[model samples]
Target: METKVAIVTGGNRGIGFEIVKGLCQKFDGVVYLTARNEERGQQAVKKLEELGLKPLFHILDVTCEKSIEDLAKHISTHHSGIDVLVNNAGILDFDKAISSYEDAKKLIDTNFTSLLTISRILYPLLTNTARIINISSDWGLLSNIRKQVWLDRLVKDDLTVEQILEFVNEFLNAAKMGKSAFFSIAGKYGDYKVSKVAMSALTFVQQRQFREEGKDISINCVHPGFVMTDMTKGMGDFTPERGAKAPLYLALEAPQSLKGSFIWHDCHHVNWDD
Candidate 1:
């Protein structure tokens, strides 16, 4: 029997690294630890090897259309069909205000838009009932999350991907005019929170689209709890390994009917309305 295959974008560091490790341990298949930098990608593979795990490095820069296309071609030619795609590659930038249009645009490209690009390019390589998991954040909640304040107003239902993009761009435009960080860009810096919100919404829309088309593929979005990693400066309540748990659960354990939903760590269902 042919082994299964998975592609993890931005798997070089932080939570992406932990996700790669978890997938390798739990799934019997090839896990492509994709990174834009060739050296970093290899380094991650080396680290995984030291742990007696098999991880192959595939250089991928999700923002580049050609790069995604090339990876799709490469994967199609070299391995078995892809069984799972973890859209983990993204960025977080902070400015005094969202008026930094250049920086804000970059965040949108990587965090929200690039996912659609990667999925489009790689969709061809996916086998029957493939899974696509978008890594989202709780900050994307509609309610403000300052420090440890839990937001209870994130509307996860009734959001389509197009609506989310519009929201992100609107925030960018609003931030340009100093209209409230497009949803709390003041504290955390950059468009991090807004971008996550857009991605989560997009995940729902993509799932709905797939279902409408009668495809059996499972598509969903999830937020990993605060975990210690380079991104969180190792200060989160959970370790990178622990933070990776929810994504791992979604990728390998979640049921098919649960597809196209916004979920929290460990595959817990989330109320988009909150």
Candidate 2:
């Protein structure tokens, strides 16, 4: 078997942490347990070592182009192309409303744009038939929309990535004007949902692009079931380990054919439009 190389962003804590731990045990490869903070990343690595797991710490700030480029350079020099890339770093804010422009923009930059930026930077370093597991959520699915069934209509039938981005831009514009009918009707934060929808859409877009380019890479998005972690303040019912299961499964264990899927942990297919 080939020696695989994997990178897990935000691997110092929460589901990201557990995914790194799980990967160390489940996959035979060099696992880069990445964190933006050098201290935190190394501490996590130390703790993992104490637990008999070996993982390397890489300083990665997914939001920063320089950080990502540096990582690409390091990987290019030290190893072959990456075998798995888990775009797991994310941020959340339930404060105020979409009209809080700064807060909303923070969400966009963290939850959506940073991952996209990281993906773009690392794309050149992915090996043939590599796996890209994007952590998403049920909220991204159009079926979660309370009404406006037509919105679901737009995402039906393996909707192309370009179409998904168009809708995402529309929703962002709606949130900017405080006219997000989805928020009003769904009674939730529209910006966050729109961002995840965009994230999930990006996974599909990349998957298809790889297919069209005849590349063997497989990019898939996954929704780890809600789990208790710092992100949830222990409110979630499951543990971080539980949430980590899905992303790790998709990234390290699932069959290749299941790649490029937007799915939930129970192996249920995600209907982004539904």
Each candidate: what lDDT? 0.76, 0.78
Tens-place lDDT per residue, model 1, 1-274, is: 8778998999999889999999999877889899999998999999999999998888999899999998988887887689989998877632244436677778778888898787678886887788888888777554433422223223444555565566666667755765454445434454777777667767777777777878888888887887767666456788778778888988888887778677877668876545
| Candidate No. with top TM-score | 2
| Candidate 2 per-residue lDDT over residues 1-274, each given as its tens digit | 5577999999999999999999999887999999999999999999999999999988998888999999999999888789989888887753544435466667767778887677678998899878888888877665554546436644555666567556655555655666455475334676677678778767776777788898888888888887777766677767888888788878877888885678887766765664
lDDT for predicted candidate 1 compared with the true structure: 0.76
Query: TM-score of every model?
Result: 0.87, 0.89
Candidate 1: residue pairs that collide: 93-190, 94-190, 154-274, 155-272, 156-272, 156-273, 246-266
Candidate 1 Cα misplacement greater than 4 A, ranges: 94-99, 144-161, 179-190
Off by over 4 Å in 2: 94-99, 145-163, 179-186
